[model samples]
Target: CATGSAAVRQGIRAIDANAARIVLVVGAEQMTTTSGPEIGKNLLKASYLPEEGDTPAGFAGVFGQIAQAYFQRYGDQSDALAMIAAKNHRNGVDNPYAQMRKDFGYEFCRHESEKNPFVAGPLKRTDCSLVSDGAAALVLADTATALKMRRAVAFRANEHVQDFLPMSKRDILAFEGCEQAWNQALNKAGVTLDDLSFVETHDCFTIAELIEYEAMGLAKPGEGAKLALDGETAKDGRLPVNPSGGLKAKGHPIGATGVSMHVLSAMQLVGEAGGIQVPGAKLGGIFNMGGAAVANYVSILDRIR
Candidate 1:
């Protein structure tokens, strides 16, 4: 999952250096073999040592804490988070490859119930991504090689930016690394956010998506919630995000999530996405993050074949 974007970068480098005409990038994760608690414990290892593991809620707890902090700083946006979850779930219904395809409406996602109880802090069950078992792969080639192929998508810009590892070392809500990656990638591509017709972003948690709105300049900090509430990130909105339902609905199979995002975004650019297709999609953006935004990768892609 974390290496997915980096793997693509390596592939691009390999082709650019003339070391290889093509490169195969793949990622897989088999997470369902373990119980939910066990998975939570494993995910907790991603956080800072000692304290994170001791937290009763595991990964969700960490993100839940982030959500709480954001709310405290900028009003409660649980409604916005629910809207994000509902939007992704609704989009997921059109994705046959998605793990959870059911469209759990906004009401079910927003309010807590016996089935949709809070996992940690304000983060409800629907706010978290699924523990999925899956694999995704892609083939990358040089421009010359791709031009000869029947179908091909080119990477307009691929940039990566890393932040401090410890959550306490930096402002968790700012996601500065994420913001930098987006700005650098777009600048390198000679385009702006509006040039992208759609995007496939890392939504390991619904809160991540909300904050990413601000990180990617879609909204000002502390106001990302308004983007969801106003439906700016909806499928038919100005810049449709996660048209494939995102990790929220498509399932976040650690290793596969990044690869799946690129695949879905490329599909949209090429008109190969049957159900979740965004008409007239010429440019696509992909953001994949690892470890609480510590490692961020952004890719701008467009179909050339």
Candidate 2:
């Protein structure tokens, strides 16, 4: 997940030190080949819950619990979560590489039906990212060499932040590590959230996007729901988030997730995103996380050529 971006950032730094002229980074995953129950069991390994425990829902279950806790602390925001899901699904319609490009409208996403069932507590099937198989790659070169290249996207700032792995060790609602990574990247890049043209954020679950809105300084804690309800993260909104449909619609192939974010963000910045391009996009931001926001990575990128 977050390792894809972190590794690319390190490669870029190594190139700057003259370790190499060109660096190629690739990430891929194949999760759909496995059986559903086995996949669920394997993903549960990432959770702090003991493997032998009575809990059986896997990561979806863990995130659903987080959603429940958030609901308890703030207020029921099922509508807001639904809005995020619908928005991303709609956005995926324009993304050619998206795994689930079909447009599932708000009504379909908001309410549970025979087609859209509950996966775990509070979280519906629409709220979860799909099991997918995908890969993405990037070629990074020195500034001088990149100048001669056909296209150039420079990393303005890339930051990584780590938090406690155990869910019990920290506040599940805060996503403090995500906030810290965004702050550090923005500061290092000498820009604010408003400076970016668009963003491709990790939306492993719709609730994650809701929490990320607050973590990225778009809204105060407990107010992120308002952003989605008001359509702020919509494609035509003030600042489009996850214009590539995010992990929810675009697909979450584990290792490929972060790389996919970078690839799509770069496409937007260079006007190569085709139907999904954010008009006149010049700068793009990407946020990818591993585990439950334990490993966080943020990269601010700008078109240079």
Which candidate has the top score in TM-score? 1
lDDT per prediction? 0.91, 0.90
- Report model 1's TM-score to 2 decimal places: 0.98
Q: After superposition, how far is residue 287 of candidate 2 from its true place, in Å?
A: 0.5
Q: Could you give candidate 2's per-residue lDDT for residues 48-96 as a string of tens digits? A: 6553233547778888888999999999999999999999999999999
TM-score of each: 0.98, 0.97
Question: After TM-score superposition, what is the CA distance of residue 275 in candidate 2 from its true location, in Å?
Answer: 0.8
| Candidate 1 segments exceeding 4 Å error | none
lDDT of 1 at 98: 91
Q: How do the residues 1-305 of candidate 1 rate in per-residue lDDT, one tens digit apiece?
A: 46878888888899888899989999889999999899988887777865556777888888999999999999999999999999999999999889999999999999999999999889999999999999899999889889998989999999999888788888999999999999999999999998899989888889999999999999999999888999989999989999999999889988888888888888888898989899989999999998889889999998999
The most accurate candidate by lDDT is: 1
